[model samples]
Target: MVVDLQARLRDALAGSDVDELVELGCDLADAGRQEQALACFQRAVDLGQDWIWFNVANTLRELDRPTEAVTAYQRAIAAGQSDAWLNLAHVLDSLGDLAGAMEAYRAAGQAGGQPEGHVQLAHLLHQQGEPQRAQAALAPALQRGYLPAVALAARWRWENTRESADPVLEQQLRAGAGVDGSARADLAELLIATGRREQAREQLQLGAKLGQRECWLPLGNLLAGDDLSAEPGQEQEVDGAEVDKAGAEEAYRAGIAAGDEWCHHNLALLLLQRGDVRAAEEHLLAGAAAGDELAQLAWQDLHQQD
Candidate 1:
């Protein structure tokens, strides 16, 4: 049955007069038959189906072959599929080929495509330690309601130390936290670093209530500090211990049960500090396998002890 279907698909592809081959290629790619899909897409491109190149590029990217995706996107651009240039920039950025990403972003801009190109260029510049240049690049979009402008402005205010009490920054932090995990974590870290531990705790508490795993590590650290100092007094105590060790243990177990990587890493550290090496190793190993860098480093330290 599968062989008959394959033969039918081949005949249909062979008889394609327009872009039917591209559609067939896309279907094959979506169904996880990547090698066959690539062949079909290559044939479509050879038949002068200009639009097929973007699909081919996207498929290559999804298959974890960014270099080939870059080439495919470039071919699409050369064939006048200018709208694909922004996506090409994004693929290059994901591959850590920032120079190529910048070039593609520039081409996307020239093509009058997404305004996000400017924001992406600015972000890349900021990451490369050219904050002033990044801010300059973001200037045009700043007045146009681009969300990245808030982040860029916050970064500028932070770097310049205009004032730690800047209301603009506070507003930006709140707005940023509403958008993504990384932004919320950044705001929390910044608040803690600036001695606004209470505020950071509040933000983290809200994040925890909302079921955000990203808040657990910093929040746990904060709580651990408070625990060591005996905050909330005897009223919050559990298991006949100060700082509610029982509650902390429960939270840690809940996080572990939910498979949170950061929770596992932080909980491992906490347990290690409490002299529970066996449990610590288990959680740390799980976290390390999940790509938690801190957990991996901690595991290395543990091995050195043996």
Candidate 2:
């Protein structure tokens, strides 16, 4: 049955207070009531709250209605809220309009625009395979202490050189760990690189507990290896110590819930090892749908089986 959002709104929106409506909309959205929140935002806009269009756009985005979100974001931009450009750029990127996203990101970083736009711009450049440009664009974000930029730059260095992270970058990641889960994950990786398996587990555990669901990926691996271990009952190194298949499954599921597609691939591997071929296939498809390369390859290979 559909929710009677208007009736619910009538209980709290009896006043003409724009701020109240916006606050209620935010509260509703936080509770996953996007349609009700959308109504609240739209009502605020009808009451001359032009700035509320940004909230409407955000709600629309959360509702997976990108076309309407883009329109609402455009209206907010037209009303002189340049920060809407940042969100609009993200929507364009999600819609696969890379060039448009690039242009919109540029607009979002200009005067009166969102400063974090530069960080996202750098991220997009990286996605488009322009590493040099991504690094260059990231400079400003780094200077501003943006955790994603710091993490990306550090990752690039480690990926290209196969050496330990630079001391300064390592320190930055540590400092940012309190606020960014990725920072904790990176720090754990640095520890893992140095053969500090136990410390790495500690970092991953804390990060996962702090609501950094992505940490579950590494944590799960550190807990259970690909061997499944039910036969030989052991692997080696981090997870080699003790193969907690149940814990690994839990971690993978949590990571999947947290939007890390790669967890599906790992979880599929575990399921396959358990002789749950159908379950493995299901997770492979889910991972493929989320653009996980390993999952896509595994799915293709599985489909080609004799």
Candidate 3:
């Protein structure tokens, strides 16, 4: 009886429609026959299973075929699959088709897929250098709790007004204490920008120990005093110059071994401070060649001094 039932099930699947084929392909994909599963999904789409087109598109994307995935996602959209629009936008962005990605994101926003879509659109707009449009795009997300309003507000205050006048920014900065790597890094940067160098250093030290690569550059710059590019009012002089110099040198050395460009630049500055112009030039050249703008500017400044 069991054998007969199994055989009947196999026969039924063998004569199945596009939807069944998609289900089989999904099973195959879950079982790790990714290539064969993709082929099966493609066959389902070719058989006009419009409802499964989005799933096929997502599978194609997982298989690293962004261009084909975009086409499949477009087909799904044409078949009235609104939910696939965000995935389509992400695939376009991954393919470096930023314009198309933005258009898809806008469409997704219009379809009311996710409130976060508006925030993503705003971020993309900001990346494209349209801050005003970005701000406008964020309005919906801001109202709907999809965006980090407090953080965004703090950032805006820091960017546009005096830090001293912005109590909210200070509160936000304090609220970020003991957070994860990214939050700690952000807080460190804000601290440095708001003239809390010691606090920034402490935060960065904690971040570095916690494996945050982003903190290394700012910490290195602070150590070297070469290009303390902290925002206005953010500079802090060390109490004991010699001890600070030694600590900075050690940090820079470790940072250089970790392949940090800012560390290389800081090391160069340290070398220059120690009157080793030739060695400083070598590090400066290396950092500049690696496309560090600060290093390039520093190298040019040093060349002018020469």
Candidate 4:
């Protein structure tokens, strides 16, 4: 129906206005008609509108043609659309053009790009062995109240300030907990490392209540009596007291709803232990789709008979 309406509009108006064409392109894109969307965007581009170039680049990227996306993005930049540079940098990174990606990221920052672009630029700089520059890049994001940057800056400061689990570190972590979910998760981890299982459980429960979904996995495991060992075959110093499975299931379901991929894997294991193979398989497939390695392995094993 959208395609037919687009055809009627094109015939009625003779496709003069670039905005109308772009709107139609967006509608087609939303409807998953990529080929038609691409055509509309290209027609707008041929009519020499700068902003339409971004749409063309996005469609190219969605079609898995990142090379063409790079060209379109560059053209968009030339046509006074500097905001497309960050997306161009992402495509460049995927194609292993790190030097180009770094340059584009810097250009994006100069163009008043989003804080996330600065975060990615800092990460790339860090990976390239430029720690000081990476820290410098993160400064702007921290000032802008980017939570991940705030958490990362807190951690870096903590690393430089203390060598072990000290009262100061605990205080700082707790202070940052209200600002970053990672801070809460880190506090829980520090408690666990110090053999404070009861404190860790409380911290994790608080973290979950504060919307830290990743906390649920550990919370669920703590409820289910599973040892949070560093590795398989390692002895855990935790007490062997088990809580109710009902609570564990509740935590796992909360994590799954909050988009934690590994929660599906953990919940599937719990379901399987309770002899619900069909339900377990359903969750295993969901986790696999979300890129959980353990879930992929479990899914392969479960389907080996088929």
Better of 2 and 4 by TM-score: 2
lDDT ranking of the models: 2, 4, 1, 3
Worst 10 residues of 3 by lDDT: 226-235
* Each candidate: RMSD: 5.4, 4.8, 6.8, 6.3
Q: What C-alpha lDDT does candidate 4 achieve relative to the native structure?
A: 0.79
TM-score of 1: 0.70
Error of 2 at 28 (Å): 7.6
Candidate 4 lowest-lDDT run of ten: 227-236
Q: Choose the strongest candidate by TM-score.
A: 2
TM-score of each: 0.70, 0.73, 0.66, 0.67
Per-residue lDDT for 217-291 in model 1, tens only? 666666665443332233443233234354455566666665566678767766766678999899889888998
* Tens digit per residue, CA lDDT, model 3, 215-265: 666666666553434333344465333235666777777667666766777
User: TM-score of predicted model 4?
Assistant: 0.67
In model 1, the runs with Cα more than 4 Å from the true position are: 1-8, 94-96, 109-112, 155-164, 189-214, 225-265, 281-306
lDDT of each: 0.71, 0.80, 0.69, 0.79
Score residue 17 of candidate 3 by CA lDDT. 70
Task: Give the distance in Å from residue 52's predicted Cα in candidate 1 to where it truly belongs.
Answer: 1.9
Clashes of each: 0, 1, 0, 0
Question: Distance from true position, residue 45, model 2, in Å?
Answer: 5.7
Q: Write the per-residue lDDT of candidate 2 for residues 1-306, one digit (tens) a residue.
A: 125545557765777888778877887887788988998999989988898999999999999999899999999988888889989999999999898888788788774446577778887898889999988877876787766667667766655764554677677667767666766787787877877778888888999889987688988887775344343333444434656788889999999988888899989988877778899999999999988888999888878983
Residue 207, model 4: Cα distance from true site in angstroms: 6.9
